[model samples]
Target: MPPSESATRLPPGPDTAVTLGIDPETLETLTYLQREYGDMVGMTKPSGRLTYFINDPAEVRRILVRRHVRYQKGPGFERVKMLLGNGLIVSDGDAWRRSRTMIQPAFKVQNVHRLIGVMIGCSDRRAVAWAAAAERGDTVNITEETNEFALELILISIFGDDYENRFMKEGDNPFAFLSKDSTRDLSVVMKVRALRNLVLEIIEERRSRNEESLDFLSMYMRATDKNGEPFSDEELLDEVMTLVVAGFETSANTLNWVWYVISGHPDIEQSLIDEAGRWVPTVDAVTAENLTEMRYTQQVLEETLRLYPPVWLFTRRSIEEDELEQYDVPPGTDIYLSPYILHRSEHIWPNANDFDPDRFALVEGKPRKDRPYFPFSLGPRRCLGEYFSFLEMKVHLGLLLPRFRMQRVEDDDPGLELAINLRSKRDILLKPSVR
Candidate 1:
């Protein structure tokens, strides 16, 4: 039986029905509501649907981790569904569980560790470009560069040889639009669907060849559920598209922010360069232990994620009635969790807006409850690529920062885009000079 809505005390909120979305206006509304009403603000939307903006870290943790089964992927993901289909990020219930179980093995530590050469290869590709720009005294469009670096890295990682022999023909990658356009509009969705057709063709080609490769596609193709059933062609395509989008954007956005921030803080950049010097002094020296031992670099990335989580907002819908703190969450209620808002909450973090990496210094090996942070989110449903993401970014900075010095062009602030993924509104320009 579900808890009765009438039986519990509702949290404070505005009397008039409010509107919410995955936009700046929606962010403003949530922030204003948090300020006006406090941590848990319950409100009726214009559609008369019940919604709660949950800022209380404990309660947010409970809903996302402990009581997660009572919820389904919610409202905002409709936008994503157009792009990714029913892959892991937007799926719910048994479908999600099955996909997650099958796909989990593909992201295992040993598997990710094998891809170090690919990571370095991608960085090397960027190095060549940055070096050219430096020789010509050009300012690099950092936003575009990170986008290319991450997008190319993910493509090559997924498709292996086909990325060059197939997609990179005609001097243009077929998947370039994905990096160039942030707007996931109808046309973009159509392009993604078309790309899935390309993926479908590749799957068929691989199936016919019965060949193995060291890439995500090969791993995903080999994954099986408990029943030993491989993913269906449709399922394979959805997961492939999911992997493509999910694999790239987080790293791209984070790297963009990382470069932008480091340029503004030379001391931090020098600290990162110094750390890279000791652990990853040369390309050949980068090892599993080296990545793990780069403590200061890790702190810098953690602090950057705190200020600007790639996916700034997360939304979910309650399946069954539930309780969060003193409030009763009735079935069919919408739930909102914003890492952007919570990470910057003044109460929990003193001088929260400041870019200080020391706050995360004490967070190493700490208990789950001790930290109120979730840049990649919490619990079982948390991002599968968390470890892989950190390593990729580390390799990117560790290798490149020591060889080149980059500072913001004209010292301009690249304000945030703040859409589905938090990105710089303006393409951040950086003047690069080889060290």
Candidate 2:
């Protein structure tokens, strides 16, 4: 790769050059960089922007955890900005700080615990649909099944009664395309922005009636900065959009792969079902205490995330001068981190290609103390919904896996689609039977 314009004492890299457009295109390029040069690889993007790929686990932590304040979100977020607007995912600096502070309370463990009922409700809905499919001896599109499960769960969690009274009453979910459509191009962005009117209307009615409820929408509406001012209508709309997209996609993709993995690993699937049987035998029994005891299920989810992190390749930019090892990172340098890469690196994970949940087994009531994993990124910018997503996945698997058994329609590999999110290139089909 060409020495970056600002390249000074940057790490050694080949001048063979690499083009980064996102996906395997980017993945392939980065992998080559790691193979040709050791952990920290630096190069100039074709756009003349200096870029550094940090696969060194310790350095990755330092950039993401210790000195995170010195860097802000970097390249490849332009399309994301169109979808999320100035919401938490796309905003930086004071805007991000204010939004995170205001929205953090809504994800408190106590708050997420209250949504257990909603998680079960959505999983039960999937059970109902799967039951009908099983009776008919029909092939189930588990990709669609998980997508609907997560989409419905997030909507109900956010809107509560409004999900039924408002969104359902209007016919199909206006945001359903998010699950069905994979491309995050202009068409999708336009569709996402158009929902602003629907969200804005909801906000307006809530303001008019002084509505209050135990749901994300209400919490977001009431969220105030240290100044004690609530989100403006536009800011509130962006937040709602961000919530829907955030809550829907990653979890859906995870549940999609969870089913695929379990289908392939019957032994692991049996363990998960047995764990669920012991811990969360029924909907009413899904207490936070019981779910916490479901460590094996958490392992399954973590392994799946390791294999296919949704937001696979992410970027950040340095805001101030920083040092990594002996190298100097000038301001405006772009940095890339990939959990997908790290999670599967042979040096980092033994037999990295294997699907093994045992690797994540809890030790003495905690995750193995030093496992280098960050499927949810790290530090303050770590996904707030980490707890919520895990519970949601565990609940889905706990309830559904016990009630139904699925066999992959064909034993062919469902290749990967590595775009903004890493997904199975083709919809995974399975024949289901009631357990």
CA lDDT, candidate 1, residue 82: 81
Expressed as tens digits, the lDDT of each residue in 277-385 for candidate 1 is 9999989998878998988898889999999999999999999989888888888999999999999999987899999987777445652346689999997899999
What's the lDDT for residue 256 in model 2? 91
Query: Once superposed on the true structure, which residue ranges of model 1 sit more than 4 Å away at CA?
Result: 1-5, 362-369
* CA deviation > 4 Å runs, candidate 2: 4-7
Top-lDDT candidate index: 1
lDDT of each: 0.90, 0.89
List all candidate RMSDs to the true structure. 2.3, 1.3
lDDT for residue 16 in candidate 2, whole number 0-100: 49
Question: Considering only N, C-alpha and C atoms within 3 Å, which residue pairs clash in candidate 1?
Answer: none
Candidate 1 matches the true fold with a TM-score of: 0.97
TM agreement with the true structure for every prediction: 0.97, 0.98
